[model samples]
Target: MPTDLVTTAGQAAGRVADALAGLDLAGPVRDLAAALPGGRTATLAARPGWAELAALGGRARRHSDALDAAARAYLDAEAAARAAAGPA
Candidate 1:
């Protein structure tokens, strides 16, 4: 897929993950857990999947940049070769 698409998808996934995590986990389980010893210390972090997707998007962008550079180099070389070969 295009790097742009990958980036957009990554951003969307990250937003969704953040929204999911933002939800309150109250009720019995939360109460029970909080009733335990160190439940108050229990904190949730960002999901690994969203992070991985974001990383992938960054990687794709880098790869795309590299690919563009290589293509330009190839075209330049081809143009040079054609010029060296004289009219035709």
Candidate 2:
């Protein structure tokens, strides 16, 4: 079911996020920004404070959180619907 797929995806994302939660993205972001061909965007990504790195990590975290929340909501709604339907 779609809910099952969502659950699996959310769980996978959450697990990955948890594992990489402490990872520092600054250096990698800087390296990538330097290597990228983009103009000012690359410069912004490589900024000294690593603010872009923080933002990137924050966005990923938020995405993972959103997925998990969506999965929970879908599961909850399915359960409620099934209960209302009752028996088969």
Candidate 3:
């Protein structure tokens, strides 16, 4: 039963990651990936669970954050490119 709950949480995390992917931002998403573990840790602190939940959540959040960061980086780079092209 706990595994099932963890699986559901994992799926939810994946969905969030997918949504973040839709955004267009700038740079590598690595920074976000690096910070994701701690972010997820904080979230789970509010509600404890078995190691499976923690592991699943951490992985999911990292993937999600990376996706979001990529989108943000893409958008920022595009904006900067446009601004640089305009007259000074």
Candidate 4:
């Protein structure tokens, strides 16, 4: 069975995922990761050329998926940490 993470980290992971889910490239110009406390690290996994493509008016869904996967990895690592810390 899987373990549950500490409430704080779980909350952080969930917020990251929720923010990814809410991304809107066309709605308004805003930085999502900058808004989170540790979001800079979270965006490190984004695709290498997302902005260049966006600047060229190309689709960025694949890049977004890469970013989402990175967020999920963080969540998974957090869960692993919780497991290592012992049962909740």
Question: Would you list the C-alpha lDDT of every candidate in the order shown?
Answer: 0.52, 0.74, 0.54, 0.48
For each candidate, give its TM-score against the true structure: 0.45, 0.56, 0.40, 0.33
lDDT of 1 by residue, 3-83 (tens): 445445555655555555444434434455456645453332221232344455456555555555555666677788899
Highest-scoring model, TM-score: 2
How should the candidates be ordered by lDDT, best one leading?
2, 3, 1, 4
- Candidate topping lDDT: 2
**Candidate 3 deviant stretches above 4 angstroms:** 1-50
**C-alpha lDDT of residue 21 in model 4:** 51
lDDT of 4 by residue, 2-82 (tens): 222333444554555555554555332234434443665446534354344234322333444455566677778877889
Clashing residue pairs for model 3: 24-75, 25-71, 25-72, 25-73, 25-74, 25-75, 26-72, 26-73, 26-74
Give per-residue CA lDDT, model 2, range 1-88, as digits (tens).
4877876776777666666666777887777887885787687886677544445555666777788788789889989999999999
- As for TM-score, the candidate ahead, 2 or 4, is 2
Off by over 4 Å in 4: 1-58
Clashing pairs in 4: none
Task: Flag the better candidate by TM-score, 2 or 3.
Answer: 2
* Candidate 3 lDDT trough over 10 residues, lowest sum: 24-33
Better of 1 and 2 by lDDT: 2
